[model samples]
Target: MIYNFEDLKEIVKSKVSIKRFNHIMAVVDMSIKLAKIYNADIEKCKIAALLHDICKEMNKEEMKKICKNNFSEDLTDEDLENDEILHPFVGAYWVEKNLKIEDIEILNAIKNHTLGNKNMTLVEKIVYIADAVEITRNYPGVEEIRNLVFKDLNEGILFEAGKKEKYLESIGKKSHKNSYAMQKSIREEIKKKN
Candidate 1:
């Protein structure tokens, strides 16, 4: 209800494609609902969801170039290699630097949404997984995951993340699609279950 649509428009103009802005807005609305359900920080979730795909439309080549040129050495090799997934990190950087936003929590939510790190904050996990399972999204097995989110978010996030990790790995057995953070998060998630 309190979304800054004009700010969103300005932000989208620079970082996201026109088509993606609507998707991001949809995620924003869904995330707000999730925040209410999960007791997460609503403002953080909204900002994170709105800006999640800010760099989604960047051509893979351009994405790679931006990441290569600007990212700190802190990024893992897997992050460097996966341009498709690296867009979130790039979007966070641009948002921080250009938009002058200093909220690390919001930035971290956007930064790690793709390959979730271990011990993510509530807002972080909610935004990360919610973007994947928003009401409007339709992919194979998505409905089950959506139901899982309402029942148990941690289980849902881990389940989907694990599934995605496996799919990415199956894409290349030797050079698996799993990132160190993703693997770490799954183990952390299992530990929580135990």
Candidate 2:
């Protein structure tokens, strides 16, 4: 895909609120740094990170309608069934349809950045962690996860996933099945390593 950073940034800035736009920029910076350490494609990382939340402000009904075709199969039943939480899929689909990205890995990273899947690729994992620990984000234990990012990508991913779980419970929201499965898989991997 031909990804022009300026064009992508303009499109994103035009669509999202200032706070979200800043978050997107932070994720882009973090993604690029993590991509270098993790040996991911930097250009793809840039595009995916910038566009990850492009549809965050979009209405759920519109997302659901477009997702009928663009996001039907890849997302979990939890995602497909719940209109409220389908931003990741909607973002991925909208970018592909509008930008002609033509890179499934980039699209996949955007799709899974919110609550990652067990089968996530390196690019996906980088984007997910970057989104969680981006400099703009202020949360408990975020510093530890930020430090762990380049030092240990797997542990960083697990840490962020666990933090996300706690945040969900505190807010009285249920995590997607992918979040649980991803956390379980990461825990097992960390255990095996230890």
Candidate 3:
């Protein structure tokens, strides 16, 4: 089940909507650029970006089913109910089980793209930031964050994580444990650099 890049693209395209597919392509483009800048594995970034949202279009029931089946111990009832938060876990599992992509970096990148984790590899950071700052993404402070990412990945991630936490609070949603751990890890990294 090893797919060439084009095969992967086609599979992703068929699985997601046109808008979702466009976002995925933008993420792929941004990922490659960040990978080149950060000296990460470009192919892994490409693969991770392509499959990051592969299960985004799935119905909530199906996503919940997948999460329950594969990540039952790792995810909570709230996590499984939140499609926005649930897709990454399902995406990673789907990519591994269906697409036969066994690369741990790629799978973790896909899994961590949504909420992020305590210790993200270079490839994971590339995919995570690229998904946020891709050219098509237009948010209030996205331009500033995008600029910050190219200059310093850790700072950019820290900023984005803070924003995500605030946004979730604004919407009356609790930030996931992984996001908090990631922010803590990135903050420590920034502290070391300073």
Angstrom error at residue 46, model 2: 0.8
What residue runs in model 3 are displaced by over 4 Å at the alpha carbon?
Answer: 1-3
Candidate 3 residue lDDT tens string, 21-84: 9999999999999999999998999999999999999999999998898888668997877899
Residue pairs of candidate 2 with colliding backbone atoms: none
Supply candidate 2's per-residue lDDT for 133.
89
Regions of candidate 2 where Cα sits further than 4 Å from its true position: 68-84, 187-194
Candidate 1: tens digits of C-alpha lDDT, residues 1-194: 34575787676866666667767887888789889999988988988888888887777777777777876454556567777667887888877887677788888898878767667888888888888887778888898888888888887887787677677678873322334565576677779879
Expressed as tens digits, the lDDT of each residue in 1-194 for candidate 2 is 57789988999999999999999999999999999998998988888999999999998778877777765665655566675468888888888888888798998899888878887778888888899889988878999999987799998888777777888899997777778877887788779889
List the candidate numbers ranked by TM-score, top first: 3, 2, 1
Model 2 TM-score, all chains together: 0.87
**Candidate 1 displacement at residue 101 in angstroms:** 0.5
Better of 1 and 2 by TM-score: 2
Which one wins on TM-score? 3
